[model samples]
Target: MHYDVFNGDADGIIALLQLRLAEPKSAQLVTGVKRDIQLLDSLNLNSQDSLTVLDISMSSNQQGLANALQAGADVFYVDHHKAGDIPSHANLNAHIDLDAETCTALIVDALLQRRFHLWAITAAYGDNLLSKADTLALQAGLSQQQAAQLQELGTLINYNGYGEDVEDLHFHPAELFQKLLAYDDPFAVIADKHSPYYILKEAYAVDMTLAQSLVASYQDSQLSVFILPDTSSSRRVSGVYGNWLANQAPNHAHLVLTLNSQQDYTVSLRAPLTNKQGAGELCSQFASGGGREAAGGINHLPKASLELLIQSVSDYYQVTASST
Candidate 1:
């Protein structure tokens, strides 16, 4: 048996898309909403099973990976997250790059010698690696207009993954991937009018309009925080909204907090693009919070701790901003 396990975000979907397009294969697909990273836990591997894991952290799935290895599964892992110690077993192959600028799709692009380079660029854009995507698009000889179209496509696809669950999302990531796979080129998806790209684009416009009306709960020279009411719109827009805010003020950190079912807050934090460090560390100070240096979140922060979180975030940026 063969299994393909990946994160349900643009980077994971595009990474798998490039691989499958290059080497057609039949594998049981495993994926979830953007935050569902511990994918290997749900699988039952056997000695003969071949598993391909992408875009998720090995550290989060360390136990599952160990059990898979013990079961004699041959695993291929590719990621750009904070991987703890990786197993060196002959059955395990890991390609992990911690470079702040890299994403799983780009890593796959390097291995594929850019056979699907444009798709990789689209994934980079989707992952919010804007500067990198711009460089790759130009290097691929895409005209300015063509590159802009690709960026918009990437952003829409990315926006669809922000929801709390499949119920909150417009299309399940797997379904979206299947629809997208029909078109080898992202441009074709955009042209199809009936494609997921168009659906996502229309939906994204409405959500962003609602989000833009929200005023920041806290704002200063170094940090700006917005606490959104727990609505489907808030859940759907939080991640992309953070990206938009970060881009709008590259010199200031941005935090988007949404009230969750438990009456606590789900926090999304983005460090200044000018100094994309300390976000993960700052977020990690709270339980259920941690991510890459540039972006991160706290899954459940008590309302009582809101003031503490706000102060820590402000202090983190103050120190880091001065150093930068």
Candidate 2:
């Protein structure tokens, strides 16, 4: 058996998409909502199985990966997140780049020599590497209008991955990936008015409008905090809204807390774009949190601990901003 395990978000989905398109394959798809990163734990594999893991951090799933290797499964892993000390197992083929400006899709793009360059560009935009995506779009000779379309498409696909469960999404990420497989070109996905792009475009507008109307729960120069309801819309828009807040105030840290059923928050943290240095460290302080420097998240954070999370984020930027 072949397992295609990936994050459900735009970067993860597109990264695997590029590879599968370049070399068609039959694989068992294992994925979940954006927050479901510890995918390896759910796999039941054996010596004959081959696994491809994308866009998820190795450290977060290290134990499961180790077990798989010991069980004789061969693993190919590609990611841009914090990767602790990688294992030296011979069954592992790992490609990890921690550059804040890159995403897994772009990593695969380099491996494929840009056969799906446009999709990589879209993933960059979706990941909120705005300046990098723009530069790549221009270098590819894409018109401004064409670039915007890809950006929108990328953002929408990314948005669909947010919700708490596949039921909360417009299309399950697996189903969405299968739908996207028909169009090797991103433009074709756009040209078909009946595509997921059209549906997500409309849904995004509604959720974005609601998100914009929300007032910050806490705001000062060094940091801003937002607490959103546990609704499906909130889940869908949390990450994108955090990106928007960071862009609106590039020098300030932003925390977006979406209420979860456990009476805790699913936290999304973005370091000041101007000082993208401490988000991963700050988030890693939490049990279920991990990510890169620019953007990070926690699957669950207790309500009583909100103050501590805020203080940590604030102090981090306060010191960095002063030094710089």
Candidate 3:
């Protein structure tokens, strides 16, 4: 038996779509929201069983993964997240390339070129790699308008996975994947009578409005922070709101912090487009967070350090301003 495990966002779903299209075999899917990366531990794999992990980083679940591989299951892992030190195993085949601009979708696209090219474009768009998606869409013979629609669907699907829990999301990504499979092409799915695109758009609008209305100003000239209430909706929409805030204040770095039910806060940090190189490293210093040069986040930060962290961010910005 084969089980496919993936992040339940655009990248994971599209990667699975490509794999299924290429392999055309039935396999059990293990997936959850963006936060549910530690899903491999729940699976029961034996020496003969095969598992394919997509878009989830080994660094996040190294111990569990090491145990699984040692148990003799053949694991094929593809991801773009930061991997500290990968253990060698005969049954482990890892394709991990940490290029901020290249996502797992592109990695799968490169590996299985002709079999699933279009779906790769969708995944890239979902990851907000617009230029890359557009370039690939053009190469795939899709017109400008078609590419735009595909990008919208990709972004929408990606956006749906941002919330803290399943309830906060626009639609459960696994359910969304079933809807996506109904159409051979995602464009057709978006245009279909029963398409969930309309609902997604409406929900995005409402969330964006609430995000814009809730602003937390700071003293630094190039830094802004927004603290959201502890709610499912706030947690789910925090990252999107952070990006929106970044756009709204292009000169400043935007941090979106939201408290969860447990009173622990999740933080999304985005550096200005001008200096997006070290935001990931900065976040990692405080919490279990690392990402590409431009965007990253800390999974959890205690409420006690909340005010101190905000002050540190402001001080960091001040130092940057003076240094330049």
TM-score of each: 0.97, 0.98, 0.88
Order of the predicted models by TM-score, top scorer first: 2, 1, 3
lDDT per residue (tens digit) for residues 1-324 in model 1: 999998888889999999998988899999987878889999888898999999988877899999999999999999987788998899999999987788999999999999988899999988888898999999899999999999898888777777667788998888888888888888888889788987888889999999999888889888999988888878888988999999998999999998988888989999888888877778878987777778888878999998998899889889877876
Model 1 Cα RMSD, 1 decimal:
1.2
| Candidate 1 least-lDDT 10 residues | 157-166
Question: Model 1 reaches what TM-score against the true structure?
Answer: 0.97
Once fitted onto the true fold, the runs of candidate 2 whose alpha carbons sit more than 4 angstroms away are none
TM-score of 2: 0.98
lDDT tens readout by residue for model 2, 161-209 = 9988888899899999999988899999999988899999999999999
Indicate the worst ten consecutive residues by lDDT in candidate 2.
272-281
lDDT of 2: 0.92
Q: What are the runs in model 3 whose C-alpha is more than 4 Å off? A: 138-144, 247-251, 311-324
Most accurate candidate by lDDT: 2
Model 3 agreement with the true structure over 46-140: per-residue lDDT tens digits = 78888989988788779768877877988889988767688788898999988767888889989986576777888888776666788888888
Worst 10 residues of 3 by lDDT: 273-282
- Please give the RMSD to the true structure for each candidate, in Å: 1.2, 0.9, 2.7
